[model samples]
Target: MHNSKNSYIHTSAKIYGSTTIGENCTVMENVILGYPQQDILLQVTSQGKQIEDFEFHGCDIGSGSFIRAGTTIFSNVRTGSRFRTGHNAMIREKTVFGDDVLVGTNVIIDGNVSIGNNVSIQGNVYIPTHVTIEDNVFIGPCAVLANDKYPVRGEYHPIGPVIRKGASIGANSTLVPGIEIGEGAMVAAGALVTKDVPAWKLALGCPAKITDLPERLQSLNKI
Candidate 1:
């Protein structure tokens, strides 16, 4: 771990190889950052589309970030300024987060995801890979996001839900794969989203019916 002089790394934290921590970052106790994933898909000769192999390459954390205790971030995870995390958060490799992101307690973010600036993810959220969360997005507590259509022994095609800018997901909501939560959309609590939600609308019910809700979008309504 190559930390800047201004960064504060706790004694109990375990940081893996070649991680570059920027200025004035705070790494709390028992935080594990930059560790690599053991399993990886090497190559596919027929398609000739070569994805880069996963390794313990490195990670770059921007300035003024704060990582709480027991937060474990895997290798190749990149983040911009003011990245904050709560306790026991697990972030995997190839995940990119923009500036002013807040990851709440016990949030598990899987690999190959892109999160934009000013995103707030609340506690106990499970975010799988191939997801895109745009700026000013708010994910409430216990929300579950998936990527694979049929995860168990499926054909390895995974497409996560896309949360657009200013979108808000309420608590205990489950978003299915390959769906889009449009800009300024609000998802209700305990909703199951199986389809795309339009911009500046509200989604509710099992299949998540959408409707124009100007009040929620304007005031940023609570779940």
Candidate 2:
């Protein structure tokens, strides 16, 4: 564990192998950083192995991060400066987050995801693997982003959604796999997006209908 200058890690926080916490960061109580992936941990435990027996590719959290209580950040995850998470957020392995990212409470970010700068993921949002969220995107509460098009039927190729820069996904929205939400697009509340939405367009309703964005809603996000 490499804790940089002015970092305050709570006594109850579990920081494992090779993890680095940057300057002026606060790791709150009950937070687990640099935890091994589920399969690896299960294998190790099943074999009665100890912590030092296996090498872990640890996580790197940049300066000014505030990881709230009950958060679990798996190994091989990297986050840029000023990353903040609300309580009970779960960020899995192989995920990368850009600067000024905010993950709200109860958010679950699965592994192998990419997130750009100034992104806001609200509470109860589920982000699956292989998703890419560009800069200044806003994912409202209860939004779910899937990666599996044909779930549990046969050979599965998981391809999640690509949300472009400044896009806003409204509350309770569900994005189907392999779709691209173009730059500055807006997805209205409770929308079930089944296909790609062009740049600066608006997607509304279940099986979302694409339409021209309203003039008032056309401005790029000020996130």
Candidate 3:
């Protein structure tokens, strides 16, 4: 564990491997940083071996981070400065977060995801692998972003949703795999988006229909 100056890590927090906690960070109790990935852990357990013997790629959390209690961050994850997470959030391996990112309580970020600056993901959101969220994106509560169209059936090439800059994914919305939400687009609450939403447009209802965004809502997000 390589902690920078002025960082406050609770004694109960478990930091492993070559993890680096940046300056002025606060890691709360019960937080687990640099936990081995699933595949690595499985392999070690199958052979009745200890995971501590392996040298996994540890995580790097940037300056001014606030990692709340019960959060488990897998190895190989990196986050920019001012990153914050609510209680019980889980960030998997190979996920990258940009500056000023906020992940709410119970949020599950599957590995291989890329999130840009100023992104806010609300509580109970599920972000699958291969997802890309651009700058200033807001993912509301209970939102589900899929990556696999056919799960355990045929040829599996997971391509998650791509949320462009300034896009807002509404609460309880479900985005199907591989769809691109264009820049400045707004998806209405409870909408089930099955295709691409054009830039600055509004998508509404189940199997959402695209429509023009209101004049008052046309402005880019200031997140």
Q: Show the colliding residue pairs in model 1.
A: none
Candidate 3: stretches off by over 4 Å = 46-49
RMSD of 2: 1.3
As a whole number from 0 to 100, the lDDT of residue 80 in candidate 3 is 100
Candidate lDDT values, in order: 0.86, 0.95, 0.95
lDDT of 1 by residue, 9-55 (tens): 99998776578899999999999887755442222233353323333
**Residues 96-205 of candidate 2: C-alpha lDDT, one tens digit per residue:** 99999999999999999999999999999999999999999999999999999889987999999999999999999999999999999999999999999999999999
Q: How big is the positional error of residue 146 in model 2, measured in Å on the Cα after superposition?
A: 0.8
Model 2, global lDDT: 0.95
Question: After TM-score superposition, what is the CA distance of residue 39 in candidate 3 from its true location, in Å?
Answer: 3.4
Model 3: ten consecutive residues of lowest lDDT: 49-58
Error of 1 at 155 (Å): 1.8
Q: Over all chains combined, what TM-score does candidate 2 have?
A: 0.96
lDDT for model 3, please: 0.95
